[model samples]
Target: MDPTGTVAIRARLAQAAAVIVTITMLAGTADLALTDVFVGGEGGHAVYRIPSIIRTTSGRLLAFAEARGSQSDNGSNDVVVRSSDDAGTTWGAMRTVCDEPGRSLNNPCAVNLTSGPHAGRILLMFQSYPTGKGEGSVATGFDGPYTCRTLVMHSDDRGETWSTPRDVSRQVKRPAPVTSVATGPGIGIQLVSGSHAGRVVMPFNEGPAGKWRVYAAYSDDGGDEWKLGEPAPEDNAGHGNEVQMAERADGSLLLVARQFGGGGRRKSAVSTDGGASWSTLQAVPDLVDPSCMGGLIATSSVGAPCLVCTGPASAKDRTNGQAWISTDGGATWPRALPIYPGSFAYSVPVVLSDSRVGILFERDSTSKISFITLELPSNAAPAAKTP
Candidate 1:
């Protein structure tokens, strides 16, 4: 106890053996395991609607859905497909990428535009409807001439096989009684720069005053001519349906919307000259929900421009899903965590290339759609790093 108290007890036993070897190597890399990738249909109460997961370039984890056989958002629907090689643990059954025999394929958005001329193809946009005789009144839902369209299907391989829903809204200029009421299956993005650089943008909720539009169709020489373009900044109240578009590493285009009245406020718009023109629909402070849909990535992580939003901050609590991180790109979003509290989740959070952060949401409350794999803490420090 003399030599300076035995060198302070050997520096507190080497800082407690470096905190027990850094908590046993983070408990063996957090046992990296997360596997639950269900996609329903076997007459088990059809309710696999509104799923859109994408990760391809050969890494494969594609999911595009709308397989209603029951949970009726309006009878018969189809468009479905699923895949996962190992990343999502396991999934390979469901597959029916658009079976229109009563038309009703909803909400799907995928992109893998290699570059202009459909450079590698893997583009799929969805929204189709036809087959009715009643229960259609949003002022006659476009006054019945029945033929709702918004399709653009293509796959140069990754999705295994596909290519036939090609009526990209046929230069949308509807006015008269050309009604079949359009409501999308909306979400698509691929236009890193101007002059339609590899264009393929789908954003929906069009007819019957459901306004909130964003429709641009272009496939230079790939999906065989899909022209339509002109409605990026048209006047539509902020009630925009479940639209989510993203591409912002300066090649600006952010569009994030969701608001069906009753205080689930989440709205954003910015197109710095890409989706035509937009920027006036703010209010994304804490991101509530109106049937949440989240997936946005504009990352350089901390070097600058960062944005990552994964559904449900609390729309009066649907089990409280979370994942909202912004580094001053979407104009401030301090930091929020909580992956999935209890059940009802609707995630989209994706950021892979080894950076790790993959979330494919929807769970419990019987919605069932999961594939969560998030393990952050490479040295953990980005809550704006304090002490």
Candidate 2:
């Protein structure tokens, strides 16, 4: 389907007076639309950064971000979220998930449990640090006056309300010799394959700033207990931190990370043992990223296994944001389509059980965050086998 059709669909939805929220059931629905759930600066914060969106099992869409006092990563930041029930046509007011007295709650990585003891439960993981410290206190060992600690919160009734945060820093972070850890800043995954089926996994990275490496914080007994996995082995293959993950059709997890150090290509790695360990890292030379956070979701959208990744498509600049589809797992991402053509920043993708895809991302204007839904064209032939 030509993306040009999106404009017509939006007009139709507006004509019908039906508000589009989240990712609508667009294929058969009479109308389709796109809207921003969070309008940044207007939400009492100077800017909203870091978008992490997910459609709960109950069908509610929760869009989370950091309400920043300034565009910079540090300062008076709070983890806030807006929810939608009618897809994207309407949204609830912004609610603070967690805010510390003098600390910042940054980088929200969340997952809705579909299986296990916490089935239907929504768990959120983030990092917290004193506002004044920022990453400046990032010592190679533990939270040095400013290095952040990992914390978690959950919602039982969709996203209407949340519970108090439980400090899980010990479970996901290490002391001394390891510093500056961050959880996702995007979406996590629930494995439905192999021996580790039903495991909850969150991708995180920590170490010194320039040498940060990725790791997984996963739980087998639902979200009650999370354990840190070995540091991402392929992480050294890339130059930056801030990672995102999706579960492959075969049950393994695929990680696509932003490449730093001149940013010619993205970095990638795979985990076969439910994120407990990772395979060697490699450079995804085809998916060029300009050192920006991206999104990924593995779903049988085309009637066969497919992995869709979203981020700015430019390596030298942050324009021409697009989604790259991989048919042969994560080996090669050849299919690319534009999501936003101008001033695109961080983005996150969620694939519903029915194969509908919803992307929430940051745009260049005042409204800041925008969402769009799309259907992956069906193809019986498997993604052309790649080497």
Candidate 3:
């Protein structure tokens, strides 16, 4: 009697243990809610890095990144994109947006024109490098194949197809002391108010490697032509690099950039003339950056004026991905919530259809590009509207 009873007790205990293990497994994965939009080493590439994302007017999400031949930035790289119909819940196949045989096309900056004849058209701006060349090797000039070139392409059908790449280097690039120029590795903005309303503004950075500076390349008649703005005034504190822009409620533009020499804090500047010229660069004290590309955008919801930025929270390393919210038109980032606590680099944030902020970022060591959605605080500011 005792033997049979003891055997039955052991069986019950074994069942209980299995149930506990199952619960633990579910618990571990319950909070891992990120979607891998572009995985590393997929689609005939060695790595996928420098993510840029946007939500089209047709209610589709497009994520773009650099598909590289090797992990190095100087290698052969192509700009690729993937679209999602259900708002990042699912993704379509990877489509190569732009590719140059033996050359490298990087920084897939995208923006959707919200007004005028090309209101729904999407424009992508990127920098084309010479064969196997990178930022350090490229020189500043208008020469087609020897110097770096800035190009643009458009898609009217919500990223289904792209037009031929047009060279805008002569229009958007500065002549001297600028050895290399790169487009917003994130996204651009279209002005909605004031004298410059409906202007498509693209953020760009010119570099001699260490002394990088930020500026804007804008088009008023839609994406047909582009013009360069004066570079942000540089100082001893920091030099701007890899930047993004947001429109304020008062119709001004705010640009946030990565600080090259100054290390810890993000650099910011403002433009009242629709990015024609920018104010002096200032450090965003609250946005602790590690010299990596960050995402900045104005929320498109209905409430107060809100701006959201995504990047690493650490000042020393590219870890701790977090969302910094500013209710006062990016005047101050008082609220921050963690997106990922480890290994986040080069992120692009977009406003989703359900009023959530979606951040597409590169994981540690330039491995993959992933997407995660974060909810805005209930008391946070709403969308900004020009007066």
Q: Between prediction 1 and prediction 3, which has the larger TM-score?
A: 3
Candidate 2, residues 205-231, lDDT tens digits: the string is: 886677777889999988888898987
lDDT of 3 by residue, 1-387 (tens): 011111111112222121111101111211224677787777888889888888998879999998888887757889999998886767889999888886888888999888987999999999888877778878768885768888899999999999999999889988877789999889999998999889999999988887788999999888898888999997679689999999998999999999887758898989999998989998887888888999998975536678888888778888867778887887888765566656899999898855577789987666878877766654433221111
lDDT agreement of model 2 with the native: 0.76
Show model 1 residue runs off by greater than 4 Å. Answer: 1-48, 51-67, 70-75, 78-99, 102-107, 110-124, 127-186, 190-198, 201-245, 252-294, 297-304, 311-320, 324-335, 344-363, 366-387
Worst 10 residues of 1 by lDDT: 1-10
Q: Encode model 1's per-residue lDDT on 1-387: one tens digit a residue.
A: 011111111112222121111111211323233344554555343677566776776778787667777666445677777788766656787778778877666667776765666676787776566543222432222223355566777888888899777665645435543333332333465675656566666555454444434444444554566554444443343565566667776677776766645256577777765565576665565666745655565555444556777676566556645556676667766564445545654456555554466677676664667666655433322221111
Per-model CA lDDT versus the true structure: 0.57, 0.76, 0.80
Error of 2 at 185 (Å): 1.3
Q: Which portions of model 2 miss their true places by more than 4 Å?
A: 1-32, 140-145, 234-240, 353-355, 365-367, 379-387
- Model 2 lDDT at residue 32: 28
What TM-score does model 2 achieve against the real structure?
Answer: 0.87
lDDT of 1 at 237: 39
